[model samples]
Target: MDTAMQDRALGAVLAGACGDALGAPYEFGPPLVAEQPVEMRGGGPFGWEPGEWTDDTSMAIPVLEAVANGARWNETRTHGRLLAAWSDWAQDAPDVGAQTRAVLGRLTANTEDAARAAALAVHEQQGRSAGNGSLMRTAPLALGFLGDGGKRPLAVAARRVSDLTHHEDDAGDACVLWTVAIRHAVRRGKLDVRRGVPLLPRERRTLWLDRIAEAEHSAPADHTERNGWVVAALQAAVSAISTGDGLVDTLERAVRGGGDTDTVAAITGGLAGALAGASALPEQWTVLVHGWPGKRLDWLRSLAVRAVDRTPGPLGMPVRRS
Candidate 1:
């Protein structure tokens, strides 16, 4: 792989984690007006430590790990691995969305079918399963499926993975759009949320196109009230990435968008990182951002690199900081 593309791949996950940690302290708070300083101080409602990532990046770790290890999305074993990893993470996760907790809690079997059934049951019982939980963790799927032929597989897998915890069509649609867009950004080094609209069911294309246009025409905070929903969450992330002047500003716009700040920023960071590359992320945030599985900057970068290049290395073995 070309070095620049590889750097963008690394940026996809690392910056995503950075965004998650950066926004953790501001989650659920009221929207911040422009010029309000945003920092990674990390002591929000969850009482997270400075630069600590939340469930957004935590849930993504297993997906990255599985894909890096050569797990295909179509395999029941792959789904089982993802479910088991998530079950383990949720056991002590400082903050997991109620929708995700419900689905994972209902998993009596570790198979893909069983997970889907559990998710479907939750959706039926709750009457809504379109939370942003799935979208927040979707960046890794894009990284895993990069290259010329990665789009179709990525789309299929993104929906299936999202369906594991979010059974609603809207949730699945959001994942497909975001992951595909991330893949495109990683390959082309540009932002284009609408690039994935063609992957959606024909009837939903125009609706999503209108939504993307709305996001482009407005600011991230405009979606805050409903940012918990998958569609609005994607909108907020897109707005931040499309409107902000740079990587830091893009993530800050997402955090400022409010309500589910970590998730929106995490989602934004993935695409923004792909477009800007790992070198574009502020070193201050990268140095501080660490999370579940006892990982830090190097490990996150390894996950992204290994997922795309499929090169063998000590995945997360610590080494001296560069």
Candidate 2:
């Protein structure tokens, strides 16, 4: 693996975990701007300890695990492995959402058909299932498919991964948009959220493009976004990054948005962390913050290295960022 890609990959995962743990203490609370320099303080409503990340990072770990050994995005076999992983994760993790539980609850070892059925059943029961649950865990897909070709291959991976649980097209759009943006961030050290819009399916592109504009132009507080809706979650992450500077600044801004602080910060962390590299992450948190489901920082780093290195590339990869 290229040393730079490895560092950026590590940065993306570690920073995301850092943001989740940092925002945990402030989850669903008032703005924490005054409480700047957010740390891995934990102790959110979920009763997590300091330095323990929430479901955000735990969910992504499966994606990294499933694909780290040269798994292609298009293989149906890959979805089966991911589903089994999610089933295993939900067994012990105490913080799963109701929608996710309902979807994954109906699955067995064979998951693709079951996932689709469960998604439809949940959607019918709830009247809507386009939550940020899928989007929050999608960064690993970005990492897994890093340099695997271009926008469309990564785009397809995003949709397939999102469809595994959050099957609604809106939720799929949010995942695709963010996943591609993360690809840009990790590859180029910058996240152009708009860059992914043009690559979307025509119908999905319209709504997603509008979402990007709203996120870019609106006030951070204007969205009043919780961590539920994919659009709202996307807006929250983009708004926080638009105004905040540096790693801590951006993450703190997301946490200060209050409701769903961990998810919002986590979303921003993947993007900002990719741009900044793992070395840019604060050493204090790096020493303390680790993931759940039996994953540590070093383990995740190895998975990320494999995710980037073991994957194959497209015939004519474009000239994206370095």
Candidate 3:
């Protein structure tokens, strides 16, 4: 790939991570509260201090690791690796979302019905709690499956990975749709959410509508609360993208829109990063988020280079060596 494409891909990854970290400190705060400038929280609720990532980036780490190791879709080892990543995060005990914490707790207890219990618990407590958790970490999937020449396969792979815990069809579908959008934006160089939403594939379009309507009708009016609403997360992401603003602007918009702010901002930022690249991110924000484990900007750059190398070039040709 040319230097420009390489830069764009790297920018996308870094921008996504930066957005995740920046939004961490204000995850479930009031929309009005988030509108106020954030104070440096050192590493946040975690010991790492300011700019550290939350569950959003942690879950994504496995996706990138799996792809980097050349794992294919539906591979048992791939799924194991994904689960292992979650296990590792559990050991670290980061500031996890309530639904995720409960799920991981069951997985750690080694209950015979752990997976089923986790899925059911989230669905019952959070009402199909897809919650943008999977969406936030979906950028690597976009990178991995780019140039595969079909969106369905990639979408299916996204669903499989996310369904491990999210399970809800709506959640899985949102993950796939967001991944597709990010990949398309990265490859095509821009995205206009209002224009692009209508053009999504039929399945994705239907899912998008269902999710948005759910959010509009059911999302709590309060801006500072966290209800684990997946639909609200999707709406906020779409809103941020439609604004055509810089990373900080988009993230602030999403975060302030309330209901799962961090997750929503993280997901929106990933898509925006793919659409706009690192330059779209403010330097101070990037520096703040550059060093968290599995969330470093430089590491993301390396992963982006590797992912691009895997893409097939023109005329079904192999990717050309730089």
Candidate 2: segments with Cα more than 4 A from true spot: 35-37, 312-321
Candidate that scores best on TM-score: 1
Error of 3 at 58 (Å): 1.4
Q: Output the TM-score of candidate 3.
A: 0.80
lDDT string, candidate 1, 169-251, tens digits = 89999999989888888777877888888889999999999988998887888988999999898889888987889899899
TM-score of 2: 0.92
Write out the backbone clash pairs for model 1: none
In model 3, the Cα lDDT at residue 85 comes to 71
CA deviation > 4 Å runs, candidate 3 = 33-35, 38-48, 108-127, 192-207, 210-227, 290-295, 311-322
The clash count of every prediction, one per candidate, is: 0, 0, 7
Count of clashes in candidate 2: 0
lDDT of 3 by residue, 89-115 (tens): 777655666666667666743332455
Return the lDDT, model 3, position 265. 66
Per-residue alpha-carbon lDDT of candidate 2 for residues 8-89, written as tens digits (9 for 90 to 100): 7677777788888888887777665555566677677888888788888888888877667767678888888888888888
CA deviation > 4 Å runs, candidate 1: 311-322
lDDT of 1: 0.85
Clashing pairs in 3: 29-224, 30-224, 42-49, 42-50, 43-48, 43-49, 43-50
